[model samples]
Target: MKIIGFKINNYKSIGSTENFLSVEPKVTALIGKNESGKSNILEAVGKLSFDRPLSSSYLNNKNRGASGEVSIIVHLEYYQSELNEFEISQANTSISFTDNRVVKIEGGLSELLNDDELLMEAIQCVLEMNIRSVWGNDSNRIKSVQDYLNGLKAITSQVYINHSARLGNLKNWITNDYTSKEDLIEKLEIIDNCLTKYYSLLPSVYYREQYPQLEASYKYDDIKNIFKEPNHIFNRFLLAAGITEQEIVEAFEDPIDGNRKTVRNRIARKIQKNIEAEFNEFYNQEKIEFQVEFESRVFKIYILTDDKAMNLSERSNGLRWYISIFVDVLSREYKNKSLVYLLDEPGVYLHVNAQKQLLELFLRLAERDNQVIYTTHSPYMIDSRDITNVRAIEKVEGGNTKVFKSAYNQNLSNDSKMETLSPLVQAIGADLKFNIGPSTSNNNLITEGITDYMYMNAMINYLAIDSALNIIPSAGVSNINRIVSILIGWGCEFKILLDYDKAGYNEYDVLVNKLDETLEDKILFVSCNEEVVKEKMWSNPQTIESLISKDDFKKLSTPYDGSSSSKKLAAKEFHDKVVNKEIQLENETVSNFQTLFEAIEIQKHNIAIVRD
Candidate 1:
């Protein structure tokens, strides 16, 4: 079974999620700021029991159900061969359920309820539970089922109204002729155990802030026995590190009749060499060597450094944490076709460079058919080589988690796409290039977004205005700070143009007094809102498009008849015409743009005086 997606509802701060929150088959990087419910998301996914977690505290405080219900849905894909094998196993196993306990099931049941074959297959699971009850408490096999069916038919409204069909089906399944007990059990087992058996194939989820500690040394006698216990801390770590029980056992054996200790030493050396080879593939701070030695019947680990061997305790906390995650990550790699890793703010103790190395490890694991969904505020952890797989969780109204993924919507406003990229705080959050345009310009005009770039660039060329300002498209008004940071980092001088609306007016204060007071004169507000907007019959003009007349706006609207179209695409089309000088415009539109350019020159002169 493979996890394809999950949906959550009424879980803590999460009121409800997307209809289906699709998960990437390989690594998924979920980015958001602190207290944005990023960690809560990972916690929900990591604690996904083979069934599901039940915690009253997990339910939302408000707008929750009377039962304080929390709903979680995990969608899985099962191979035909695996499903066949699971059905075969369930039929041969014996089970009993005569305690009269109510049975409950949840998640992804609508499909089964809709399909007749699937509904019958699911009904068999309930049927098999009743038939298996005959073996409970050594009761008479036939009478136990008969009494159960009789009781199911009598004295119970639930069984009669709900299960009269179950009684009718019982008559068809249980024949009058006596049969061997094994034969009856075999007949009952043919019903299918898709739900239970699917759970068996699922990989167990393990979530932790600190990895289980590995002992420095262990007695060879105890090590052999302890290795048999899969859940033993030491055994788990060793297994995750690719150590095998058979290898450990063989290490202590004298197969050729040589000294036992000498034979053990030879095999131990090979194991140590393999550990070093695997560990070093992702860590490059230094060339590390592992030394596993057996002396006086005790096995001890030593870390080799600079030609000196040191005890494992002598290593840095960062290195120790890395080793713990490395082994645990690779533990299931060889056994399962795919794995889900929910790492919550991984590499907290590691420095920037060390965190970079840790991210490399995650990428390497993802390549081996594992999916890593980790939460992080750090940009270094995000693999931005592709932005489509990234998802952002932001706290919205009523403190609920809202995912900003409308960036992919074809007709969404530029603001929607910008909101999705906000959580990717740095230049690397989206498919943005930080070092390209800014480096080529000495003095720059950073607009609120690409909308300004497309329209303004076309107008400047159309008016034949001589200008040296390099117009750059920012992420959006909300991301002005990040744009400022990028420009400051590149040692570039720039001015920002803000719209005359709420977000823009408030951003000036946020940028100057709050972010950096030095930018007081570097910020400029739109001049068209007063002169052009009030004079025109158009309801309101907040952008450069407002400077264009209605006839021109309709001209760029493309098809001249479509009610909805991508504004960005339309802007590009207008820009192409203006650049080719194949289009003519109204005198008012030309005058409006000229007035805005003249105002910019005056603003630049005013800022220059203050600087001097």
Candidate 2:
């Protein structure tokens, strides 16, 4: 079973219904400022995988005042086949069979077959009478009954099939006549044994938690001992790296006393090659090599860079932290077993780029069908392109924590919550600044906000244009002029694509008057106005949201409920649908977007020609 999501209640800093948090299946990131309860969400989620009671320290102070029960409910998704297996396993344990000998008796005689002494005596008397009657008149009938009884005895001799078949026969006999009490109890015991084995083979949920303290130490002896254990995470790493315990022991064993350490050197080189191969997939850094040596009956790890070797512990804090945690995770006792991994602020000490590499590792692990839930405030850890994965946590009134799907609800008006949302805000701002701010790329498109960037990029990719343009989003239309001024000062060639509404027009006019005439051509508006768009596309106001087809527009509008913030949320949903391909673009809508791309491409071509 995979955990789809979960709900938390009465946990620390989470008091009431408003304090609950929802988790995503693959990689759920809990992001908020310090003391905003991001870690609390991770802690609560960890509690669900195991039957552990909440520590008294974690009980919500606010809820304790009201005597509320602290609980967490996890929603799981599994195959019907698993349920069938469990049921079949349960049924196998309760199944019973009877002795085949009892089933062969004739009906009139079966009624008198309760006690062992009486039944045997009656059967012998019937056999003697039948034999005498059939001795010369019906010898064939006598032989047939004898053959049937012999076959039943032969079947009962086979141990594997005998017990169940015997139980079945016993059950059938019990339906007609009472059986011996000892025989009935013996048959029940047989069923119990079958069930015990069946239940043992059934699958169960496995949970593992990796705390930061586990990765804090990297001493060679400690690392070596960890690899010797079967279930240690480091052992898995070594196995994945193509090293065996026997080989490790051999490397430590010196065949020659002082012969340049040939065995240890060869193993270390092999390990280095494997380590580099594994780490390079996620980490972008200078080529790293490892050296393993046995000194004073202990193994030491050294890293080689620039032809110089340094102790592994001497590496940067970020690299050391990453390596330690990576080893710990990879070495998990149940790494191969299906499990839900709960990581709390993992890689917190890593550099921004290393944290990003750590995110890549999380994705790789998740691809193996395991779910990962982690908490982080670092923007690098958040996939900005897919903000739907983010769940923002904040402290509300009465010291309660609340979680929000930030991408689903863009215009969260509560200013008090904004402080807690600073990490996400900074993440988006960083993304914008990195993509469109002073850089080598000359072609850039600046839009009003995330929705515009989303729609425009989706259109650009859908059209498959070859333009080398980077799309950036200003906080809003009011902020567009400041971004334009900054780009102009940087001597960066950029195009301003704005909404065709009054606010957008006002911003465009103000920006034009502030900049010189030379940069005027870089500014443009979306193709259609409110009146023309309403007549052609069946939507009003001519905003980017209106560009979507009527059907999608209706779907987006369902969640708005006439609230201003809800309208912004609806726009976010619209953008997500368009980008995720959930909403099919109408031919007319595609044509309109194609026209926009054509305009931007033509502008880019003209600017390139001018520069040439």
Candidate 3:
């Protein structure tokens, strides 16, 4: 089985996240500031255990007056399947066995939502009726993942007709009377037996923050630390690779050439090859030749790079971290079953490019039957190209943590948006080129064309209004969708500013039709993240040109050019006058533009562009 997602709620800084934080099949990154609850999230997922209960500290939320039960759960797929792609194909089985038609959840309290009910019922039905499975302890079996994925697919389908109405408050049902959060705890134990076969097969999660450095020369006595927990990660790594005290002792007693068929040399060669391969592939820092020695119980490890040879301790922390994680992660694979690696600020010590290299290493580690979930503040660590795996975490001062699956969360308060979505500026900004040079700020405003852009700029400049939006002029109203798509791709924080009139409303409806809720909601709100912009300013149908008074527009217009050309010339003239302080804009014109600007400010205009 594979972990497709994890959810954390009612923990230290986190509240009930609306949905499961989906993980890309390979690797995932939890990104935010230092105290934004990113590290807490990693720790929570790592703490999932069958035998242990949460500490008393976990239940304490006196700070935020949090009274809800903690409900953190992970969704495991028997086999990874895309939405609507999994088919319920049962395996043909003839073995006579128990007729029990349950998948463990029969032991827990019910009244589950329709989706959960169908999911469990479907799994149980398949487990009872049609499974050619490998039965383990307590009759827990390894049935085909097809049945499991089909159950999830039922709820995750693209076709809207397949969805059920929000029947009831899921929170109420889940916590109706779950005494001391037993129901939530039961979920972990229940899945341990029936639903999560592959999850159960793995050993306990190995979480780490303090990575031990590689030792150049180990004393004979240091071998005793091999089986130790977290503190001796480098030793644990070596142990996982089947290197032993016995082999080291023999090497000391009987030294031989590396090409010989000796146990020590073979071990040395393997370690040398793996260290070099792992380092070279992931770390973009100076390339080095490994000095892997098994000549004695005092085994030596060294690296020669940049024409200088140095022991592991003499290297930079970043280099040590890179090599250490390489050995540490690979060692986990030697345990026979896959394990989740909860890494904390993995590349914090690395520079920009080196941090990016660490991300690549993590991707390699996750693809090998293991899952890697890391937390970081650096944008270099996040892959915006395919961001399904990225979860932006935020915590307002003295507020519960809010985890957003998408950067475009309308629910985010303005401060939260600036805090959580800021990393995306450099991450996505560098990836795409724009027709216009963007203002240093990211609160972009997409306009229909140059005339609207010029007029808005002029108005803002003249009024001396501290407008936060850096207006971006698109080719026309019809071309807005293409720019919107690009902004969405970059995960940019922006708004669409169009003429609030009939033609604009029709195009808005067209946008509403073209993109689904997930895509459209990020960029297609009516006005400034649903803040009903400019409603009282004018009741008549109007264009951006209407923002200026009729007499002022007539004063600026020319008889030489056509209508469109005339508007462009008029807009330029007004902009020059505003910039040079040559003309004082009328009170009505100033009020009209300020009304629109205030609406944009209040909501940050994710969508408001339309034309008449």
Candidate 4:
């Protein structure tokens, strides 16, 4: 199951005007500046969880003043097969076998019985038939019905079942004036069980924030009691370790009962193995070993690092935070269940790289039948390649928050919102600028931006020309001179490739005048006939994209409706075709690129000869 999208109304800064935010199935990043209601969006989505509901305090202050009711709707997509399977399982199981199903049925029946006498009669007759079929004799019918009804009543008072009604509050219908006929009531219980199971198969939503610190001095009794709650797999494992009541009593009396000690050690080893496995999935560091010890009449957890033992509390804040969260999540018995995770500012305390690891962890978790929506101002957390996954939350003039599909969309002109998008922009910009990886190669080629880098790098690799030469993109035409200067200062042998535009020529002139004459040999431009450019071009400024034939240009830009940005994007597509060997280059285009490549190689050879 997945959450496709959601809408929020009268929730804090999220007014009714711009409340809808479409969520991606895998990872949806909520990008916004502080106070832009990013957290509010997460909170509103969280209220859709069965465990969480819209509260009075959650109402927007502005809406409260206007006496408007707060509303939130979450759109979900679920697999029909899973729902069918759940229904089948519920149908096969009895109410006494599953307390959760019983409670939901009771609650559902109670609400349903408020009206609809005809429906009630129909349900009663079905129940009577079911009871008669299951318990053949009338003598056994009363005891059986009383036992099933008692079980339902007991669970209804104690447990809060998370299933919603399937057939218009049928559980409420059953609860309302349940027939005294034992057989009929038993049959009704079966129907309620099926309804509850059907509801459980639906996609569930869960809200997670930073975990709180657990008490340090918790003894075996405390751990044992808490572990029995069935919250997570770790707790379940501990409970399954068979820590009997007699064992607890023996531990208090002797503090070293052999059987009790063996169980504790076995549980500790199991937990350590699981934690290490989870940790290594996201982090590659020293192999972490855990030791569970009973000291000072308390259960203590410690980590073994470099053959030295350290208490979990003694670890760094980041490590502790990771462990706490991992353990907390591992403790959840429903981890494998399909869930929509709404994470608000996750990994705020971790370093940038660790936060990146956390992002990887989110992806890994999402791959396991889950969708994760998180809010982050950090660029490391954003997947720049898939900008479509980003939703920009911006504060409007009236203090209402609006969400934009993409931060880079030209439609969003708000200066503050743009500022909020800075991290993402900078991240992508940095990637474009430093196309070369760390290496000792002296041959470096600097281009304008990603498109230029992509085109040239593809050509270089296709031609197998000087594989050692690093291709670096300056991010923009204007940054070329400054980047060249830095490369020169680093004593690197480099060549600059710029477009054939007026600005490109101007920057070339400025750099030649600014740098020493000795370095002037390194500067170059894309060679295209000025007469041909003037005759064939539709625009004044000629870029490297102008090198393509007019027919090919038309083919590329036709899909984009001839817009400049679209043309630029189309140019990228054209480059991809060339790189993939899909397009046969014209003789003139091949000659032009060959001339450029030769010029770059000649410059490198000349520089090397001069140094030798």
The candidate maximizing TM-score is: 2
- Candidate 4, residues 1-612: lDDT per residue as tens digits? 455667666767777766788777678898888998898888776755433334445543334322355666555554445546423221111111111122122322233232334434544565444434334435554464545444334332222243233222333333333454454445455546553543454356667754565333466656667655654433533433334445444545554577667766665666657666677677655567767777766767687888999887887787767666656554543444677778888777776667777877777767776788999887777754334467788887777788775454444545784577755654443233432221335566777765566566545544545446666665467777776666666566677776766667666667876766665577666663323243233346656665555555555534334475664456455655655566655555554556666666634332211111
Query: Higher lDDT: candidate 2 or 4?
Result: 4
lDDT of each: 0.57, 0.55, 0.56, 0.57
- What TM-score fits each model? 0.55, 0.63, 0.52, 0.60
* Model 3 steric clash pairs: 498-609, 498-610, 499-610, 504-610, 504-611, 528-605
lDDT of 4: 0.57
What is the lDDT ranking, best to worst?
4, 1, 3, 2
The model with the greatest lDDT is: 4
Instruction: Give the per-residue lDDT of model 3 (tens digit) for 463-537.
Output: 655555666555458767776776766767777775665556555656667754453443432233343234432
Backbone-clash count (model 4): 20
Instruction: Tell me the tens digit of each residue's lDDT in model 1 across 276-306.
Output: 6777877888877777776766778777878
